[model samples]
Target chain A: MTRYTQPTTFYTKEHEWVTVHNDLATVGITHYAENQLGDIVFVELPDVGAEFATGDDMAVVESVKAASDVYAPIAGKVVEVNAVLADKPETVNESPREKGWFCVLEIKDGAEIASLMDEEAYKAFCEGL
Target chain B: MSDPTTENLKRTPLYDVHVEHGAKLVPFAGYEMPVQYPMGVKDEHLWTREQAGLFDVSHMGPCFLSLEDGIGGGDEAHAKIAALVETLVPSDIAGLKEGQARLTVLLNEDGGILDDLIITRPIGEAAQGSLYIVVNGAVKDADWALFERSFQGKAVLTRADDRILFALQGPKAVDVMSDFFPGCEELKFMHHMPFELSGTSCIVSRCGYTGEDGFEVLVKPEAGLPLVKEMLTDERVKPIGLGARDSLRLEAGLCLYGHDMDPTRDPVEADLAWVIQKVRRERADFPGAERILKARAEGPAEKRVGIRPLERAPAREGTMIEVDGQPVGIVTSGGFGPSVDHPVAMGYVRSDLAEPGTKIDLMVRGKARPAEVVSLPFVPHNYKR
Candidate 1:
């Protein structure tokens, strides 16, 4: 079972989204990223306890067409991974925002979250592409 | 994401039609081709297997090869022209019957594959001396340059690539094409005939790369737009893209030039020895015939075979194949096979380990993923005999 907090979600230019709750952050690709991938068949998630730097490659998503890398949005240590994606990678395409969340990280610095875009700014960023 | 680079990419005659139907265009073989439509690659690939799928193949090289001294009527002219082309390829072109076609390869002097192509003999008596040829788009200029050097004044090459060449493929291809070209069912697999439709001349060939029962139509530039638009109106026919095309052919065990086989690989090693006729093998009279025949007799050191990744992930091209950590082979093409419901791949392994059921390890992302050597065509071909 997981606990909830008053959360604030932020977006990255590479199409990743992170929702911060105190010192913890949950990471996943944005809906726009998954839609572009199309029918993702496999998702390679980082192991729990793995450490990552800002913009480091943390996961890989593969569609029938090709494979794409998902980068870490902020420096942190992974605490949990979405294991359900191993059996049902299509969840990324079907419900990218909710059930498809990739992993949870314990952040080292709260200030890094400020560099990401808000919901409105992220939606506008996708439209320009 | 890339506007500057795409600005220089060439567009096909049906570019506007693809855009109108919501296709995602990407750079392929120097052309901006649709990689998928709103339906996406997986759905589009399965749709082609269950129903008919239309494809824009305008980028392919289509041409007519004929004698320069002016072609004469009857069998004699065909024999002369076939003899000229036979000098470059290993297939028995001279034996091709009227309206018959053969899938063959362009060989280098050392018998390495330059490109794979289809050569056909037209039906009409007046078309005897000419052979209809289609080569890969990326290497068309190189192929034509070789032809000019070899044929010189002996033969002439007339390129028809400016015209629109499209393929209508799948089990229901006949149903869709019948509405456009009646009496098409009479043509058997690997055969073709010319047709006249409302002042437009078209060549319909009963062959395709997807291993499905289908037709490849070569249409003049003037009538391409309207004819393709009309074909799309059929519910069974949907426009396919390069993404589905790759997966479909991979499932069919067909080779893509510069992938499964290249200039360094010969026919026998590529498991394409079937293209060589008995007469050609007996005579030993093609470029690099000595090396190719020697490998055929004793077998090549490496052989291309079908492979399946036992795990969920796919082993893409350039993935190394090993046995207990020892490198033995390498994957040339691989990806998720939507129809097979798993990952299917093709690669070259040591001849000793090429048999079906031989176990191999695929080095993907620095990890040894278990895989097995399997027979070709993960999906059975549905060609019309």
Candidate 2:
């Protein structure tokens, strides 16, 4: 039941969402992405302290239908992951933008977040697909 | 996503209904079929297991094979028709009771399975000596050609490919279907009969790809929408798409013709030896009987077995399986079983590695994930007697 209300949230063409709070950016897939993947059964998350470049494959989200790669929208080091998803993967479908956040990353370059699409831009991008 | 060349795809009789119900259509078996609906594949799959799910199987090939001369006068004419069909596939067709149906495999001369089909002998006295057969949509043309060539000048083939075939499956299917067809509840699994529905003569078979007790109704194309809409009026009945159909059948341990087994694999290797009856084995007269019987006696080099991956990651089709670091087989069908709530797969492995409890590794994205060779039917079947 979690809602997407945060205004600082950004999105990638791969359907990942990034919400910047101070220097840390929280990452998770968008609802549009979860709908396409169907019922998620497994999620492979990166470990804390792991470094990733912008657009690098950082996690794998597997659903009943297919497996998809979640890429990092900004270069950063993983700081935290939603360990709850290990046991309740359906959260990605139920609350993808909020409690279903995959991980929190310590941002290395704040400017990379600006390059991503905002909510309005992301909506249009999804429509194009 | 829409396909640019969707005009080239064939649409089923219920295509507009699917579109109206918010189905996500995709190209499958040359048809623009609905893969899933707004409820999603997982929900559709689980719903069918608990209630009743209706599927548009109109894309499949449903036809009748009748002897040139009218049948039912005596056993001689019936036996002649059965013998003609036996020439193409290995099954005890002559032993099939009037209303009984049998699942058989179409074999090539080299002992490979061309396709798997359901053949049922009509029950009505008027339709005697006629066999109602349903083959895979992808290979229906080839099957028709085989039938024409094999039964040249002996029998007349009637194509009902334009007919609407709907499969109403799951636990509550009997209750919902019995209300409509009245005597359908009396038909046991693998039995079929001709019934009149709303002034339309239709054939209802108490069988389905899903392990659940169900009935497949074949009606005229014009009656397809009305029949489906009427069935949906029942609270337990929901329109299911191919996505749930695949998962449900996979959990039931039913093989998908192209994905699980194709013309390259034989029945014995596919673990379908039961389809080859004792009488057929003794006669050794069907196509590829020499190699099929030999494999049945000595065992096939590789056999299909169910697999349970120790990890949550599904080992999809084409994933290589290894035993103690040595490659032995490849997965033919693998996916997350919604009913079992785990990842299940079926693959062909060396006969030695096909035993239950044998430990193996599935190469998923180049990593060796632990798995075990287990028995088929990730979920137990619930067929009504």
Count the clashes in each prediction. 0, 0
Candidate 1 C-alpha lDDT tens digits along A2-110: 2336798989999999998978999999888998999899999999999999988899999998989999999999999999999999999988889999999999778
Best by TM-score: 1
Worst ten-residue run, lDDT, model 1 chain B? B1-10
Off by over 4 Å in 2: A1-7, B70-72
> Which runs of model 1 end up more than 4 angstroms from their true locations?
A1-5
- Report the C-alpha lDDT of model 1 over B1-385, residue by residue, as the tens digit: 7667788889889999999999999988889999999999999999999999999999999999998987768799999999999999999999999999999999999999999999999887787888899999999999999988999989999999889999999999998888888989888999998889769888999999898899999998788779899999889999999999999999999999999999999999999999999999998999989999999999999999999999999899999999978999999999999999898999999999999999999998888999999999999999988
Candidate 2: Cα lDDT at B344: 86
Q: Clashes in model 1: which pairs?
A: none
